[model samples]
Target chain A: MEIIKIGMADLGVAKPPSRLRTTGLGSCVGVVLYDEVHKVAGMAHVMLPESTLAKNGEPTVGKYADTAIPYLIQQMQKEGASIRHMVAKLAGGAQMFAFLGTNDMMRIGPRNVEACKLALKGAQIKIVAEDTGGNCGRTIELDSTNGVLQIRTVNQGVKEV
Target chain B: MANFTKFGDFQFDVLREIGNIGAGHAATALSKLMQKEIDMKVPQVRIIPFDEVADCVGGAENVVVTVFLRVEGDSPGNMFFILDMDSATHLLHQVTGISKTVQEWEEMEVSALHEIGNILTGSYLSSLADFTQLNLQPSVPGLAVDMAGAILSYGLYALGQTGDFALTIDTAFFEGNDQVKGNFFLIPDPDSLPILFRSLGVPFDGDY
Candidate 1:
């Protein structure tokens, strides 16, 4: 099976027998959508919540949940997968530091989780499983063949969703 | 987000000098604490993508012990002191008489490492502030033993709003025989670049 690596603020789509993976998700969230019928999957390593937060002239779509989710859905459709049939599995929105206080940016992990949920809701996509929040960093892999998301953490070995 | 590409060679050299003074002070502080000679590599100033930021110390999945602090005041930004697990343990053993044989880090061991990071990073920033005459204050240091990517990403939030690229001033230090090694990464907020340069009487071209 081919393992496609997705970097931070990046996204990709793959078919059956190919897996999508992202490493070291701290405050960032990893959103994965899979269609068992077509064996198609798309993964995005979202660094922030909204594109409106961007101060750059041109912001990359895969960098934020607001842009990444819709873009990933479109890419999946291009791969012959129906949006309605795609199920989402989320992982890796974590507060890596615990004593950073209540600053909005300090709470980025939870905010990222909320943003991804709102975006997924707008697309009418249902989230089947998630492993998010807390103060640990996670590395996740989504297998297109079985629509399973494997979550790995430093202290907590590995679990499947 | 702040484009180091726009910074001319002279500007980069200035920044490198800034890192040098800061890390040099920090290395001295470490040596004083351990009573052992510590050497620091010349600081590097570069603009890098978020994906490659963790590669300086190791890979993204490489587990490390990091102390993170939010830099506030004239040149607001983020600062981090990162050490590999082995080095963290060694420093702890040398400083606190803690046993390094244990695989898992106990509470006291973690606390000892946190204090070391706090002192080292504090001296680094304080020396920079003194040199630049910029009112730079560091928030309470938060310690974490986790993947390098996860630990380092916390420093990127300020830059995330501007772009995927981050301008970093990195300094690496090691003890004799390579018993302990750690990295210092300082990422100033985009707007703070001009303020920092102005404080140093250096003219910065931001209209690229």
Candidate 2:
């Protein structure tokens, strides 16, 4: 089976006999959207909560939760996946460090999770499973064939949802 | 994204020098702490894509022990002291005589590693502050043993909102002929670049 790799602040979609994978997500979040009927899966490794938070010229669509989710959906739609049949699985918004309270960016892990959930809700997509908000980093993969989302961490081994 | 493409060789040299000054002091402290000579390498300053940042130490999935601290004054940024699994074990063995593997580490081990990071990073920043005449302070150091990508990316989010690329100053450490190896990474926020340049008497705005 082919595994499509998504880099940080990046996204990709895969068809049957393929998997979408992203690794070592700490403060970032990994979001998966699957259309079970069509066997299409999309994954995004988003680095921040909102595109509006960008301080320079706009970053790529996959860099933030608000922008990445919609962009991933649009890409999946173009791949013959229907929005009505889509469901989401989420992982990897971890507070890797203790709360310092001085910089708001230090709390980015939880904010990324909340932002992804809000974006999914705005798109009217149902979230089937999520493994988020912890002090550990995670690597995640989504299989297009069975819509199984697998998450791996340093201490906790692989778990599927 | 802040434009790293426009950076010139002179600007990069400045950054490399900054890394040298900081890590030089840090290495001296480490050498004294371990009572073993620590070898230093010429610093590498680069503007790397977010995905490739973790590749500096190893792959994204590679497990590492990291000491993270936030720099909160003058030129605010992030600092990380990273060690691979084997190096972490060896460091513990050499420093505290704890010959246990990373899996066998307990609270005392964790606290020991955290203090080492704090002392080393504190030395790195104080030396830099003295040289630049800039008020730079580090938050209490935090320690985590996990995937390199996960740990490194925590430092990237502040820059993530501003750009697709991170400008990093990296200094490699090898203790007594590579017995223990580690990496010192200093990633400054984009906004701080100008402040850093100005503090050093380097012109912030000019064509190169």
Candidate 3:
């Protein structure tokens, strides 16, 4: 069992015999793209929603879902994975802040989840499962060999995504 | 109502001082973490009633990173760190030293970002402790999705009140051409508000 642990500001790609995992996702979005036929999987833990916001083009590569998802897809395709057979699973998007008053526009978790869905939809990838939106944080795991996604929230038992 | 107004101003002043000291420490820590010269300005402080935070923060279109901390001791209260996404990602990259072009969003990177939150929240809370002469131990910093509504809602829910006073600090970090903007909110209930004010030596008369 080869376990590839993905880190913040980093992405991991694995082939059939490899599995990828990321933990403690709060506000940040974790994405898993898997091709069952080729037994290939890729995971991205994005901090922000879009790279264009990064501007300067200096560090815009995979920081946002807009850029990260496309890059993961291309990488998977290069490794003999077909987009037609690929499925997406996502987790994380917690609202962890407290505010007082009518200025409640700072809902980054739901926006992130929505943005991820939009990006995936634009790319024509089927989203099979998603565990998102809450006041609590989560951890996500992806198994490449079997294309299984597991999500666990704090104080909440692990469940399939 | 008059008493609440007076108390709000008093608390705001103390929170501003806290934000200044906290942001200064955060900048110093960030400079060390990034191994680059970093500059941060004293945050602009505002004590806003709950219903006007969105307007105060300019509508929250951009990304926001929020950290919730439960503070205990002499001055028991809650503190939140709300940062724009641009600043969050920039700070994340600077602290982690990950190549700017790598975009795969791996799990390790997310873990790395958590360390940034820990540092910022730790430094800020430590400053708060010094200002209020209170013992404040913050929990491990965690990330949350939204900035304005969700964080405020969650915070208020925890406090179980409709209207509360928030100390908001506007801050900026600059390193060469890279810059980031963020805010720190000190949400103390009405009762704790007076205690915080007296600690900071701000007089409260309930006027404006």
TM-score of chain B taken alone, every candidate: 0.95, 0.96, 0.76
> How high is the DockQ of candidate 3?
0.04
Q: What is the lDDT for B86 in model 2?
A: 88
Docking class of 3: incorrect
Could you tell me the TM-score of chain B in model 1?
0.95
Off by over 4 Å in 3: A1-161, B7-12, B55-61, B100-104, B158-172, B201-208
DockQ (C-alpha based) per candidate is 0.80, 0.87, 0.04
Q: Return whichever of 1 and 3 wins on DockQ.
A: 1
On residues B126-150, what C-alpha lDDT tens digit does candidate 2 reach at each position?
A: 9989988889999989999999999
Worst ten in a row by lDDT for model 3 chain B: B156-165
- Each candidate's number of clashing pairs is 0, 1, 36
lDDT for position A160 in model 1 = 94
Candidate 1 on B82-118: residue-level lDDT in tens? 9888888888888888876435777777788888999
Candidate 3 per-residue lDDT, tens place, B116-172, comes to: 767876887787778778666775455554435434434432222222334445555
Q: List the per-model TM-score of the A chain.
A: 0.98, 0.97, 0.90
Best by lDDT: 2
Error of 1 at B29 (Å): 0.5
